[model samples]
Target chain A: MAKLTMTVNGRTLSADAEGRTLLSDFLRGGLGLTGTHVGCDTSQCGACVVHVDGQAVKSCSMLAHEAAGSTITTIEGMANADGSLSTLQQAFQDHHGLQCGFCTPGMVMSAAALLAENPKPTEAEVRHHLEGNICRCTGYHNIVKAVLAASGQDVSGVGIAAE
Target chain B: MYAFDFVKPGTLAEASEALSHDGALPLAGGQTLIAAMKQRLNAPEKLVSLTGIPELKGVCAGDGGVTIGAATTHAAVAAQAAAYYPALAALAGQIGDPAVRNRGTIGGSLANNDPAACYPSAVLASGATIVTNTREIAADDFFQGMFTTALHDGEIITSVKFPVPQKAAYAKFQQPASRFALTGVFVAKFADGVRVAVTGASESGVFRWTEAEAALTANFSAAALDGLSVPADGMIGDLHGTPEYRAHLVKVMTKRAVVAAG
Candidate 1:
């Protein structure tokens, strides 16, 4: 087993992971960070998206040991101090960005990464950036609305009514 | 996936030695390797990750071309190669996705030699050099066939050197499901002549469309390729498309690439 050391959600965590341990499995099972969901277990779905060193990456496609010494941010870390929802999270809630919410963590993480890089993403840019992220519910209308709204874009006629 | 041991060697020598052992596979980015392992497609006894070696992760421009470190992420190439090789950067930017591009490396893509991969077309069209730890292999002699390369056991790709062309562009017709190329064409024009490489359509992997190249070399324009067409005899055929369809696409994509290059 390799001793994987990394800072996750602003906290340094250590875990003993095997060579076959995926970063998604390591985060959920080893460190108990269940916020990073594994919807597909395959790399195609972005449900396992997380920020490694400020860049969005699919955790399922990365080995835990390879991510040693890096700073990781999950959906859990994407909140303001005192555990309140950040602007992005609030935008999701206000925009009805989720229905079952199974894909919320990954969606939120991916959106945060997108806004970080391109803070003023357009509707097409937001949709293109989220090509890897898949949502089974809500038809992704509100999800796109949430991301665009979070980017401070006016989403008045963005998608079907958020209701 | 079968259980395996993992190692992250800090240098090329150590990584090579680690991979020299039986059932040890070098992992770069693990975008494809990890996914394959999970599917029980490739279960090695050990994984030697190349990410730990700092020297294998960067980009530099000189010698009339661009040199990209093997482990440099596609995101890095997209951001770094923009000013030097805009077409290459554009291709890199559209690979897989924002997240996949963040983890997938140019070396890993080239080494795996995925038929639908974008880098092979770019590298071949640009006449790049694949630099391994021991020797530099020309792009023409590097790719062998589907999921195959000239790289031998324990050999590691250190970087790829891409010669900048006077004009270049890549046009990819991608499958919606996998986002891989249905038929991608890269057209590159150099001082000597023009090179046209087509990927995702050939059964033999990425190969130059020599007929298209000759026509474009004589006159670098989409009009030059009016009568030129790829033969469907050896093209890949699957549910995505038939061999004839892929062959037709090769010609179409080449023309689109030429127009874009202009």
Candidate 2:
């Protein structure tokens, strides 16, 4: 076992996990942050996506011990301190970006990270950026629209309903 | 994943010592090793992660060439193109996705030496040098076979030295599901010679297309590769494509890459 100390969702978290414990397993099993799903144990699926040191990564592919000193952010960290939805979260709801919500958390986190880096991305850029995050629902049409909407644009013509 | 002992060595010496141990695996990005472990394919007893060794991560430009630290992420290499190596920068940008690029290290990818990997083609075409702790291996001799490399136990790749090319291009037909190249070709022209490498085709791993290289050496033109036929005997055959299909793709991609390089 190894001792891990890091900040998660702005809280300084600490734990002792086995070397084989994946970051996703540690977050979901130990800290009870089950919002990060595990669609495929392989790195192919982005359902376990999270921010490590402010960069998006697949937590399943990383060991919890490797993330000892990193600052991690998950879907639970996106809301305001008062529990209100974030701008991106609201845009998802407004544009119907989600269907079954299985891939929502990962999609939202990836989109949030993209907008944080490049606030304004073209439709093609958005599609390319979100390629890792697979959504079986909504076919990603509205998700792309939600990202554009959060960037302060109306993407209704891009097959998404405008708020 | 099977239970394993993990150690983060702070120095290359310490990491090397750990790697020298029996059944020890050096972990770079964990993009491939960890996934294989989770699937119960490889269960190493000890995992020595090299992330703590800062010396293994950076891009240095000198003497008309660029030496990239083995641990350098694809995103870092891709983002630093205009100031360093432009052709390499472009190749790194097209690997996997942003998340994979951020975590996947160049050394890890090359060390894994997946037949369909993108970097092997680029490195081979550019005639890069693989710098190991013990010795340097030329690109032509580095990759031995699928998921196999020339790296001996206790020998860790420190960096890859690439000679700056006059012109280079990588063209690949990516497997839509995995984003790995179903057929990829990298063409590069240097001061003295033109090298062309084809990856994601042969079961024997990356191999130089002598016909394409000879043609390009004589005349670096798309028309140069028009009549050459890559042999289908040793190419990989799988669900994505057949050996003959991959052979055809090697020529098509080579022509496109030559045109792109020009």
Candidate 3:
């Protein structure tokens, strides 16, 4: 085992991770920050997306030791300091963005990264940016709605009229 | 994934020394290597992390061409190369996805030389130079075949220098699932001549289409490729497409690239 040290959600965390331990496993199993999901072990799925040094990357595709001395931000780090939902999280809740919620953490993280880079993304950009993250619920209608809304865009009448 | 020794070398000299060890592999971005390790496809006894070497990570544009550090991530290339080479930047932007782009490096992509990868097409078409620790190799001489490069063991790719072309563009038909090219074509027009490279279609690997290049050299337009079609015998035929289909796509994508270049 190798000793690893990194900043996660603003705290310096250390653990003994094997050479092969993935960043996803370290965050979820070793650190107890289970919000980062690993839907597909392959690199195709972005369900384990997180910010490493402010850039969004798939955790499952990176080794935990490779992330040493880096700053990592996960779904658990997105809440407001007062322990309330952040604006983006609130947007998801207000728009009913998730159903089964298995892919929410990953979706939120990807969207937040997009917003961080491109603050006012178009609906088309949101869909394009989400190509890596897969969702089996909501058909991504409200998810797109939630992202646009979080960008402060008027997402009224954006999705199908099933409501 | 099997347990292995991990070492982050702070300098290129140290990294090169570490890579000289038997069963030691250079780790960059870890986008492809880590995934291969997870599937037990590769089991290097030691992983020499090159991320700590600051000299291997940026872009420098000169009058002759643009030189990009081998370790520069695709995302960085997309954002920085836009001003100098829009077509190259666009190609980088469309690779895999946002997350994959964040972790995948140009060097790793070139070294892995995945058959369907988009970089080889650009590098070959642009006549780029692949610089290593010991020597520099031309793009035409660098890529050997699918997942193979001319790089010797223990020699690390330091940077790639691309000559500024007067006009260039890359067009690709994604495989949909992996987002890798089902068929991709890159067309570049330099002062001397036109070069065309095709990826994801050939069974032997990425190759320059002499017919397309000769035609484009005379006309430099999509209409130049009207009667040209790549032979189907050597084209790749898999679940994504048939040999004939890929052959047909070669013409279509090349024409699209020419039009886009203008």
Candidate 4:
């Protein structure tokens, strides 16, 4: 067993788990942050995406021990300190970016991270960036719109405006 | 996942020593190994985590070449290689998603040597050197076969040395599901010679397409490969594509890569 202490969703938490414990498992099982879902056991699916040390990563493919001392932000932690939806989350909701919603949390987290880095991304940029996050429903058109909208742009008028 | 003892070693020597033990696996980025372990495909008795080894992470440029630490994430490579090795930068950028690229390491990818992986082709085409704890292996001899490498048990890859090429490019047809190369080709022109490496096709893992290389060497033009044919023998056949389709893709991607390289 290994002892892991990390700041998740702005909370400093620690736990002891088997060496094989995945970061996704640690979040859901240990910290009760079930917002990070596991769609596929393989790392191919981005449903388990989260931010570690401010970089987005697939939590399912990461070991909890590997994440020790890191700062992680899950979908549940993306909201404001007062518990309000982030711009991306609101855009996703406004644009109908999700259906069935299994992949929403991961998608939202990834989009949030992308916007954090490149606030104004083109439609192609948004599509390219979100390639890792697969959605079985809502064929990505709305997701792109959501990301564009979240960037505070008018999507309809200017061919998925950037910035 | 099967229960295992995990040891986060702080040095390469310590990690190597731990790997010398029975059923010890060196954990770099854990993007590949950890996922395999979760599926019960791998159950090492001991995992020597290399994350604590500060030395095994970063990109260093010197002596007309760049040395990338084994634990350096793909994102780092993508974001930084643009100024050093543009082809490598583009290839790294095209790997999986932002998350996988952020955590997956070059050492982990090469060590795993998945047939459909993208890095092998780039490494081979660039004629990079694989630096392990024991010795340095040339790219030509490092990849043995599918899911196989020249790494001996307990051998840890410390870093890779890539001589920046005059011009290079990687063109790949990615598997939509996994984002791995369905068929990928990397072409590079070095001071020594032009090297062409193809991945995601051969059953023997990554291998040089000598004919294509010869053609490109003679004339580095897309039209130079107008009638070239990549043999279908000893190629992989899976649901994503057939051997013939892969053979066709090899030529197509190689031509595209050569064009991009020019």
Q: Model 1, stretches more than 4 Å misplaced?
A: A159-162
Instruction: Please give, as one word, the docking class of candidate 2.
Output: high
In model 2, state the lDDT of residue A12: 89
lDDT string, candidate 4, B1-262, tens digits: 8999888888888888889988998887887888788779999999998878889998888999989999888999998778888899899889888888888899999999999899999899988999998899999999999999999988999999999998899999999878899999999987667889999999999999988888887888889888889878888999998999999999999889988987
Q: Write the per-residue lDDT of candidate 1 for residues B30-73, one digit (tens) a residue.
A: 88888898889998988899988998999899989899999999
The iRMS of the candidates, in order, is 0.8, 0.8, 0.9, 1.1
Best by DockQ: 1
Clash pairs of candidate 3?
A: none
Compared with the true structure, what per-residue lDDT tens digits does model 2 show for residues B1-262? 8999999998999999999989999999988889899889999999999878899999989999999999999988998654767778888988888888889999999999999999999899989999988899999889889988989976899999999889889999999988889999998898788998888999988888988888899999999878889878988999889999999999999999988887
Model 3, which residues run further than 4 Å from truth? Answer: none
What C-alpha lDDT, on a 0 to 100 scale, does residue B195 get in candidate 1?
94
- lDDT by residue (B118-231, candidate 3, tens digit) is 999999999999999999999999999989999998789999999989999999999888999999999999988999999999987899999999999999999999988789
Q: What lDDT score is found at residue B183 in candidate 4? A: 94
User: Sort by DockQ, best first: what order?
Assistant: 1, 3, 2, 4
Name the DockQ score for candidate 3. 0.86
How does model 2 score on DockQ?
0.85
Task: Estimate, for each residue in A1-163, the C-alpha lDDT of model 1 and write its tens digit.
Answer: 7678999999999989988888999999999999999999887778999999999999998988878999999998999989999999999999999988988998899899989989998878888989998998878889989888888888887656646
Of 1 and 4, the candidate ranking higher by TM-score = 1
Q: Interface RMSD (Å) of model 2?
A: 0.8
Residue B54 lDDT in candidate 3: 91
